[model samples]
Target: MYCVQCEQSNKGGCAVKVGSCGKTAPVADMQDVLLRIMQGVSAYASLAAQKGARDAEVDAFTPHAWFTTLTNVNFDADRFTALIAQALDMRAKAKACAVAAGADLSDLPEPATWNPGTTASELAAAAPFAAIQRFMDRDGPSIVGLRNLVLYGLKGTAAYAEHARVLGHEEAAVSAEFHRIAAFLATDPTDVSALLAQSLAIGALNLKVMELLDAANTTRFGHPEVTMVRMTPVQGKAILVSGHDMGDLEVILRQTAGLGINVYTHGELLPANAYPGLKRYSHLVGNYGGAWQDQQRDFDAFPGAIIMTSNCLINPEIKSYADRLFTTGPVGWGGIPHLTGHDFRPAIARALELEGFTQDAPEQRIPAGFARNTVMGVADTLLDLIGKGEVKNLFLIGGCDGARPGRNYFHDLALATPKDSLVLTLGCGKFRFNREDMGDIQGIPRVLDMGQCNDAFSAIQVAVAVAGALGCGVNDLPLHYAISWFEQKATAVLLTMLHLGIKKIHLGPTLPQFLTPEVLGVLVDEFDIRPTGDVADDLARMLKAA
Candidate 1:
C-alpha cells in the first residue's frame, strides 16, 4: 500500500493507506505487481533480442503494462491485476520461445504471483521474496526521492509511448529500452554513473518516442493548421473529448458521424482544431473548457457525456453524472467506465444513451489557431517581420498547469513579455494566456498555441528551425524558455531541453519536490536553470540577456 510515484504522497512519504490521486491500497499494490511483471517481460525480451530473436516481437508488451500504472490512468484494481497476469503470461511465452530456440535461459527466475491486495511490508514479512521490500524500507530521503523521480518519469514515458502505439506507430527500440529500465529498477543498482546515465537515456528515448507519436499524429491527421475554433455550444446532442489523444478523438468523430451527436474538444484535445483532417468534421465543434485542473467545475456545468483520453483525471464527485464520464487510453478514475482496445463504441453508446443537449446554447469562443505546422507555414512572413525589426524575440512560455495559486506567474509572464516578442505555448498552461488578445506582429500571431505537452517536440523543432533560418545556434536565437511544470511529462521535456543544451530557462510553480538541493544546485550551475520570480524582473533579465 505504499506508493511514491506522484506529487501527492501520504504522510509517510508514500500512499500507505489511500493514494492522493484516489487510488486505493489494493490498486497501488496491483500497480506495483504490474510493474514487476513488466520487468520480467522486459528481462526475457532483452535476453531474446540478444539471442537473435525478432526484435519487434521480443518484448513489445512492456510499455503497455508500464503505462497502465501511471497516476490517474488506472484505478480499477481488478483490471490492473488481470494486466499483471497477462504480462506474466507474456513473459512465460517469450521465455518458452527462447528455450525452444536452444538459447541458454537458466538464469531467469520463476514467475511470481500477480495477485493484488498485498502491501510491500506484508510481502517482506512473507518468505521467498526478492526483497523488494528492503529497497522500499530504505529510510534516507535523498535516495528514495531520486528513485521516485526516475520511476515517475518512466511512468509518464510509458503512457506517451502507448498512445503512439494506438496510432499504429511502434518503436520497438523504445519499448525494449523501457523494459530494460524497468528491470534495472527491480535490482539494487548502486552505480551512480549508471543510474544517471539511465536517467538521461530515458529522456533521450522519450524524445524518439515523442517523435514517433508526432509523426503518427501529423501523418494521420495531416500537419496541424491554423483555424479559429468557437467555444460556443452547437445545436445537438453533443459529446466532449478531453485530454491529448487525437487518435481517439478521430475514432469517436468517425463513429459518431450521422448519429446527430456534436463533438467538442476539451483540455489538451483543444489543439485538435489545428489539425486539418480532424477539423474537417462539420459536427466537430469547438473546445469546451479550460485546463485539466479546472475540470471539476467545468464538467459539472457541461450538459453532455465527457470522454477523457489521458491524464489529469480527478476522482468523480457526482453520482448522477458519474455514468456519463468515460475514459480511455491510460486515463482512469474509480467508478468511471473505461473504453479499451482502440474501440470507443462504449463511449459513443454512452453519449447517445444519455440525453445530451438538443439545442445550441449561447457559449463563448476563443481563438486557438496556432500549432507547429500552422506557425511554421507562416515562417516566411514571420521572418519578414523579424527582418524589418518589428518582431524582437520569441518566448516559449508553457507547461503543465495545476491548482496552485502561484501559477498566476505564467499568465503574468505571458502578459509581461515585450509587445515586440511572440509568446509560444503548449499544454494546458496555455489556458492562462490562450484567451488573451495578444495582437500579432505583421502576419505572425503573438500568442502561438502549439499542441499538447508532448507537442513540446514541435516547440523544439520550431526553435531548431528558427535557429537554422537565422544562421545561429538555437541558444543564440532570440528565444527564451519560461516553463511552468506540474508533472512528469514536463520533467521529460525539461530533460530534452537540457540534452539539447538549451540553457537559462525559467521554471516554476515550484520545482519538483523530489529534487535534492545538491541536484538542484547542479542544474542551476550547469544549465543556468532558475525558479520563476517577479514577472517584471524575469522579463527584464531575459530581455537584457537577449
Candidate 2:
C-alpha cells in the first residue's frame, strides 16, 4: 500500500507492506476503494445536481466519509468494508436519479462504473484504478501533488462542515464545492495550472466552511470568553470528552448532568469551558490532558470512563485503553462500543463503575477561550498598547500536535518570544508550552489562546482586524504565522491563510509528504511558505522581521 498524504511521506513512494499509520495492506486497499467509490459518487452526484436532483445524505457523506479516511482516523477494516457497500448503493441511487431526470452519464470514469464486490477479498482485487502511486505517477509530481492538496484540503473543509452539520447547521455552498472538487479529482487531470486554480478554489470554499463553523459554534454555545480551566485532577466519577465535536460533549453532558459524573474537557474540547451554555452545567469540570498524542498516559492514569468522540483515537497496538474507551460520532474502533444516536447510557454506566481520583490533585490553571469576540472586545486595549510601543509585535503559533519530534521547537519558540510581543495560540500545538508562565504584555496575556483548530477562524479574524486597524494587509502587518500540522484540518486552515494572501508562513515539524518538490516550490514561490529551522534561528528570524 502507498499513502503519502501527511508529513510522514517516504519520497512520495511511501510503499510499505504495512502503512506507517498502522494501516494494513487489506485496510489500505479497501480505503483506496472507498475513496474511489466516493469519486464515483461525486461523478453521479454532479450529474444529478445538473438535473436538480441533489441528495443531502450523499452531500453530507462527502465530508464525513472523506474525514474517516484521514490519517489516524478510522482503521477498522470491517467498517471500511461496510462503508464501501453503502457507498456503492448510494452511487447507484444517485446515478438512477440523475438519469431519470434526463441527465447524461456516459462520461463517468470506471469508479462510476466498476462494481466493488460483496466482500473485502473481492474489493482488494476489484479496484478499477491502478495503484495510487502508479496513477499519480502518470502525471508529474506537481500535477499529482497539487490535486492531492485540494483533496486533503477539501477533506479538512468537510470535516469542519460535518461538525457544524451535527449542530443542525449546513451550508449548501460547501456541499456544492465538495461534490465539484471530488468529481474533479475523479477525472485525474494532468494540468498543474488547473489544479492550482482548484486548490485556491478549495481554499476559498474552506474560508466559507470555517465561517459557517464559527457561526454554528458561537450560535450554539455562545462565543467563547476568557475562562480559567484547572489543569489538575478533581476527585469524582469523571468522563473525559475529547475531539472537535461539541454536540457529542453536549449529549453526554446532558445524560451525566444530574448524575454524579463529572465531565472534564480533554484535548480540543477544552474550549467548552468558555461557552456560557456548556459552563452553565455546574458539573462540567476542568481540563485534564495536553495534546491528543499524550492521551495514552492521561487516559491510562484517569480513573473514569474515556470518550473518543472523534479523530486521534488511540492505536490498539501502541496502547490498549480501548477497554475503558467509548466512541461516538464518526470515530470508532473494533472493540470499543460506539454510542449511537446520542444514547450514551453504556458510556455513562462505564463511567460510574470506574473509581475516579481519590482526592483533588494540586490546583493548577491555564487560561483559554480568547476567541475572536473576546480578543476583539479587548482590541482597544491591545492596539493602544501597541501604539504605546509596549506590545511590540504579535506571534501567532498553533496547529495540530503529533508524536513526531522537533515539536519541542514550538516549546522553545514560545518561550523565546519577547515579553513585549503578544503570543497567540490555537489548536493542540499550544499544549507544548501553554502552561508556561509567559505573564502579560501590559494588561494582555502573553499567550492568548483562540480555542481549538476550528478557532483558527478567530485568529484569522483578529489578524485581518489588526491589519485593518494598522492600515495594511495581513502580510504587511507586524504579524506572522508559525503553524504545526498533523492532519487535514491544518491543511484547510493553511489554504484559508493563503486565500487571504497571508504570506511568509513558518510551517513545521515536517512538510507534507504528498508535496513533491514541484508542489512545494509553488507554495514557496507563491506563498513564501517555509519549514521551521532551529528554535533559536526561527525565533531570531521572527524577531528580525519585527
Candidate 3:
C-alpha cells in the first residue's frame, strides 16, 4: 500500500503503513483499486457514448464514483468494498451497451475483463488485482506522471460535474470527455507529446465543468450578491453547512425554514450568505469556523449538528459530536449518518435536541461572493480607480489549505500585499488570512472572496473582463497567480489556468508528489510553475512578474 497523492506527503519514507491523511493502508489500496476499475468502466462507457447510446445513471455515476476516492472524501474501507460491487454492475451495463453498438471489446485491458466476486470478502481480495502502482515504471516517470496527471484532473472535473448534476444540470459533453480520458489512461499511452496534449484537453474539459457549476449555482440561487456575513453564532438551535455543494444547502435551508433552526455557513459555504435567494431566509445566520483543515476544533466547539455536504471533511475530534456529524452527497465517513434525500430530519432533529449557544457570540463579520457579476457591477468604478493609479495590481491567493507549517505563508502574504494592490481569493486556502482586515481600496474591498474552488470560473471571468477592458490578453493583464494545490481538484484548476495562457503561477504549500523531476521540469519550462519559497520573496517575485 503506497499513497502520496496530496501536498502533505511523507518526507523520506513511503506511506505503505498509513496515509498522511489518516487513511489506513487497506483503505488506500482499495481506493487505488476503485480508481483502476473506474477506467475499465469508462473504456466501455466511452465507446457506448460514441454510438449514440447514453445512460443518465451511468453518466452521473462516473463522476460520483471518481469524487469518492479523492483524499478525505471517503476513508471507510467497507464503502469502497461496497462500491467495487456497484462498479461491476455499472461495467456490465456499459459493456452491454458497447456490445449492442458492436464496439471492439477484445483490446480492452484486464480491468475490463476481470470480474469481481459477489461476496464482500471475495470482492476485497479482487481489489488488489486492480492496483495502479504496478504500472509505475521509473524509466518513464514523466510519461506515467502525465497520464496520472490527466486522471487526477479528470477526478477533479468529476467532482465539479457532480455538483452541477445534483442541481438538475447535466452536460453530456462533460461526462463524455471524462469517460474518454479515463479510457485513454487505461490504454497506458506512453508517448510524451500525445500525453501532454491529452493533459491540456482535460483542462479544457474542466473549464466547461466550472461553467456548468456556475450556471447551476447562479441560475438556481440568484447570482451571488456582494454581502457581509456575520461570523458570530446566533443564539438558537443552529446547524453549520460546510464544503462546496450549494444544492444540498438550499434543500436543507428549505427543510429547516420554520423549525427554529438557524443555519450558519462554514468554510467554502461561507459564500452562500451572499446569494440573495439564500439570505432571504429568516433562520439563515452567519458563518462559523475557519477552513476544512480546522474543522476538528471548530466542529468541537459548535454546540449544534454539523452537515458536511462535500469534500474537505476531516474525521471529527469530538466523540459526542460525532453522532451529529452527518454526511450527504459524495462525502462519507465510517459511522456518520448520511442523508440520501433532501430530507434533513436527522440533522434538524439533532439541532433541536442539542443545546446551542446560551448567549450570542461577539459581533464579527467578513465579506464574500465577489462573483463575476457582483465584481463587474462595480467594475467601472474599480476600473476608474485603476486608471487613476489608485489600484495597482491584482493578486489571486487561494486554493486548498493543508495542515502544514508552510501554509501560514498564505496568511502572511495577504498581510504583506500593499493596500494599493487588490487581493482576490477563493477556495478553503483563504481561511488562513481571510479573517484579517486588508481593508478596502477606495470604495472597493481590498480582499475579495470569490466563492469556492469550483467557482474558479468567476475568477477566470473577472480576469477576462479585465483583459478585455485593458485591450490585452489575460496573460498581459496586471494579475498574477499564487495558487495553492492539495488534491486533484486543484490540479484541474491549474490545468485550466495554463490552458488559458496564464503563466508564472506560484504553487505551494508543496508540489504534488505524482510529478517526477522530469515532469516537474517540463511544467517549469513550459508554464513557469514554481514552488513557493519565503512569503516576502514570493510576494515580491509575483509582483515583479506583473
- In terms of lDDT, model 1 sits at 0.74
At residue 489, candidate 2 shows an lDDT of 85
Q: What is the lDDT of residue 87 in candidate 2?
A: 89
Lowest lDDT 10-mer window, candidate 3? 5-14
Each prediction's whole-model lDDT (CA): 0.74, 0.82, 0.84
Comparing 1 with 3 on TM-score, the higher-scoring candidate is: 3
Worst 10 residues of 2 by lDDT: 7-16
Q: What would the per-residue lDDT of candidate 3 be over residues 335-419, giving only the tens digit for each residue?
A: 8888887779999999999998888988898888799998999989888888898988989999988887788888888889888
Comparing 2 and 3 on lDDT, the stronger one:
3
Tens digits of per-residue lDDT, candidate 2, 92-184, equal: 887886787788877887678877785866887865352465565467766767777887887788788888888888866567677888788
Better of 1 and 2 by TM-score: 2
Clashes of 2: 0
Q: Rank the candidates by TM-score, best first.
A: 3, 2, 1
TM-score of each: 0.90, 0.96, 0.96
TM-score for candidate 3: 0.96
